[model samples]
Target: MADAVALRQALAAFLGDTQYRKFVARGMYRGRMAYWQEQEWTRFTTAHPEFAVDLNELAAALLVCHLHGDELKPDTAEVFHGCMDLARWYVEARSRLFPYAAQDVISTEGRPFEGDRIGVLFCPACRVARAGWRRR
Candidate 1:
């Protein structure tokens, strides 16, 4: 319902500083500087109940951004094994991080294709939280 940034900040608060920093330290994010508060995040997610059901990729990006400071992109991100297949498409054929379909379609990460919802395919081989130039 809200924008990507909103989802990310709320996720950061929900995750907490230490855990949130992990994604950032790993170069999972692109570049960014922002602020957040757990209390506000609590309120937002609560109001948006669907958010409670799913939030893996966004959470990952939030952590990377807050810790690193930049937008969310692959080049700025730390590479992972076999991730190039997914990343090289550069955001699903460069069509945006999550693109929706007109009709009903199945998706992963607990986020069903419900009304303008976006989906992503994480490294199927590995969760690879530490995406840091593994493919040098």
Candidate 2:
């Protein structure tokens, strides 16, 4: 998996242009990312007003790192995977209390080419492409 630094760089590249870098340098990305991410939660919260506990943020962090493999510390791959496992656990455990957007699990735009497959989540679209992984 990519290390934190690499992931950050990838994120910068993904966002494209120098604007993202400038934004991060100014700490604006952090706030924007947080706000947008909160939007994801807010949609769920409205339906489940009692929902207040969650740790998907950690999974998201690791996912971003894993997807940006070239940047994450090479050795941290396992750590990132571990975090994903826990994140899955958290999602499943809390599903009964707070409904999760199924589409969120499987990516919609497909995985990034520069992304690491080692610990990346398979989106439904990807599944359609690889449905014949072991065709007889």
Candidate 3:
């Protein structure tokens, strides 16, 4: 098994990668109008096989996060939970092969809101992952 710390770092790197960012941005924009080309997904999967599952989950989570904001509606909670589960798995696995990193620092910027057990409602990891997905 890969080291949890390394896996987290690698995930962070992948989330920060410029090409990955562009791919995700494109997916988010174009994805709404039509399905992504099989070739595009194939190219991405070929380039980052280790992240195939993660990317798929992230894409789903991003759509949910975008449509619903921090509020995880019942219909979208499954996707959100899936991303969180994947994050937990990666953290536990400690994989260490993160080759992609953003040329510039990736920021996790957002406004704060008040709520009971806000952390549970709007997880930091979820927010950062969403930001990475939305980043251009």
lDDT of 1 by residue, 18-67 (tens): 75554343432233223343344456568776565233454554433333
Residue-by-residue lDDT tens digits, candidate 2, 1-136: 2243444454455455454433332332433445644554455446444433334332333332122122122221111211223377645533332221122233324434343333433233322323333241
Taking all chains together, each candidate's TM-score versus the true structure is 0.29, 0.22, 0.25
Candidate 1 residue runs with Cα over 4 Å from true position: 23-66, 74-136
The lDDT for every candidate, in the order shown, is 0.40, 0.35, 0.36
Quote the positional error of residue 74 for candidate 2 in Å.
17
Model 1 deviation from native, Cα RMSD in Å: 14.4
Could you tell me which 10 consecutive residues in candidate 2 have the lowest summed lDDT? 74-83
Q: Cα RMSD for candidate 2?
A: 17.9
**Which model is ahead, 2 or 3, in terms of TM-score?**
3
- Candidate 3's displacement at residue 116, Å, is 24
Worst 10 residues of 3 by lDDT: 75-84
- Residue 25 shift from truth in candidate 3, angstroms: 2.2
Q: How close is candidate 2 to the true structure, as a TM-score?
A: 0.22
Residue 23 of model 3 has an lDDT of: 44
Task: Please give the ranking of all candidate structures by TM-score, highest first, separated by commas.
Answer: 1, 3, 2
RMSD of every candidate to native, in Å, equals 14.4, 17.9, 15.6
